[model samples]
Target: MKNWNQQEVEILKSKGGVIALANPYDNLVTTGVEPWPPAEVVQKLYQSRQTRAFSEEEKEKLQKFNGYYSDFQSIHSEDAITWSVFGTIARAQIEKRNKFISELFQTLDLESEAVESSEIYLWRRIPHPDNLVPSGPEIDFGILTNDTLVLGEAKWKSSLGAAQGKNKDKNQIQLRVEFLQKYAPKLYPGVHNFVVLSVGLNNDVTENYTGKTVKCISTTWGAICCLQSHPHHDELQRYLAWKIKNTKNG
Candidate 1:
């Protein structure tokens, strides 16, 4: 495996950008926030994880500078993209936030009813209904309202992961849907929405995951970047635009 720091440095170079340092802690090159978002906002998002226990993998990842939670230098990181986009939304003024959410729902063909009141949580671990795994899928982010839950899986240069160990037949989406159907309601008590947010996706995902009980909607990071206009969005938009361009050219 490539050193995570080197991977990010290469991605930045590929975009015709340069970095003074290759380290995540020093570079803070993310989807493009400099030195990260406001300390309070980042702290609140981090604190949300305290609501539940983390798996050993999650705990270890949290400790590493290049791991998802601490990573801000990687342009190819899904967590970096997720935090930059939604973290900005989390701190936006209510009107602008709601407007952005409304436009996002319309773009994804989802109902707009919950846009105004939803709460956003990042990297939340939902327990498996079957107890077959040590921990269930750690959702990239979740938008929750009184009657609706939107679980998002984000990608930049990667594809959705496959099931490991004993559950080889199911893909990550299937596992997430299983949680959405079997366990989500007991915790959130709402209509479920499973969204695959990516630059582009394989057809197999849509063909295999969409069903009556759970709807798997596919949308791109570029589409999301287009949904809002805010000063805070400038860096993230520029970063995602480069990613989308590169993804298409290849």
Candidate 2:
């Protein structure tokens, strides 16, 4: 249902060919699915907050408010164009909270009871190590339990490295771990890392690059809608392949 692009082709090759993804639905047959919430509820919670097109007035507001875009008119950036992707990430947390956060943990084989008891958090601001005002990388979403923690970063069409950037000690994931260690030492050493992205990346790349420090999962509009929408294995495989082939960062 989707057309292939260069990035998708490359990602497929990187992941040992497209054969496995070719029929991803096969794996979905056994995946358990909870019924989705009603349409109105979903609309209220997850609807995109972006205007269909960026109008002159909206551009002026962004230029005035978002410092990052102050010079947007003078200098063009593809990244800037996609900045609103964060809206998708926020909506995902608000609407598909359970499916994206809790269900994903279950899919990853995290402890059932712990995941069931997990709470989702959106870290828009990070406090300094000294417990000062928020002053660090902004994390997207997190799932926390008494002993287990899952840190997540969301992106629409960017790789984890691109989205996270290169920060030595202030990395978002590192910040989260350090925060828990400093405040709630009990949750230390119980960290599980995740990246929710809609781009041309595979688990193999994620595991190899991070040395398995984090688990990478795909999302739609920054939500884990692939497996959640597929009640049958066949549909899962098809939709997954489609998503992988379509979502290119550039």
Provide TM-scores for the models: 0.65, 0.40
lDDT of 1 by residue, 86-106 (tens): 766766667766677667677
lDDT to native, each model? 0.54, 0.36
Backbone collision tally, model 2: 4
Clash totals for all models, in order? Answer: 0, 4
Itemize residue pairs with steric clashes in candidate 2: 24-237, 25-233, 25-237, 29-233
Most TM-score-accurate candidate: 1
Candidate of highest lDDT: 1
Candidate 2 lDDT over 178-217, as tens digits, reads 5544554433455444332222233321322232433344
Stretches > 4 Å off in candidate 1: 1-71, 132-134, 190-208, 229-233, 242-250
Regions of model 2 farther than 4 Å from truth:
1-102, 114-118, 129-133, 145-147, 156-170, 186-201, 204-223, 229-250
TM-score of 1: 0.65
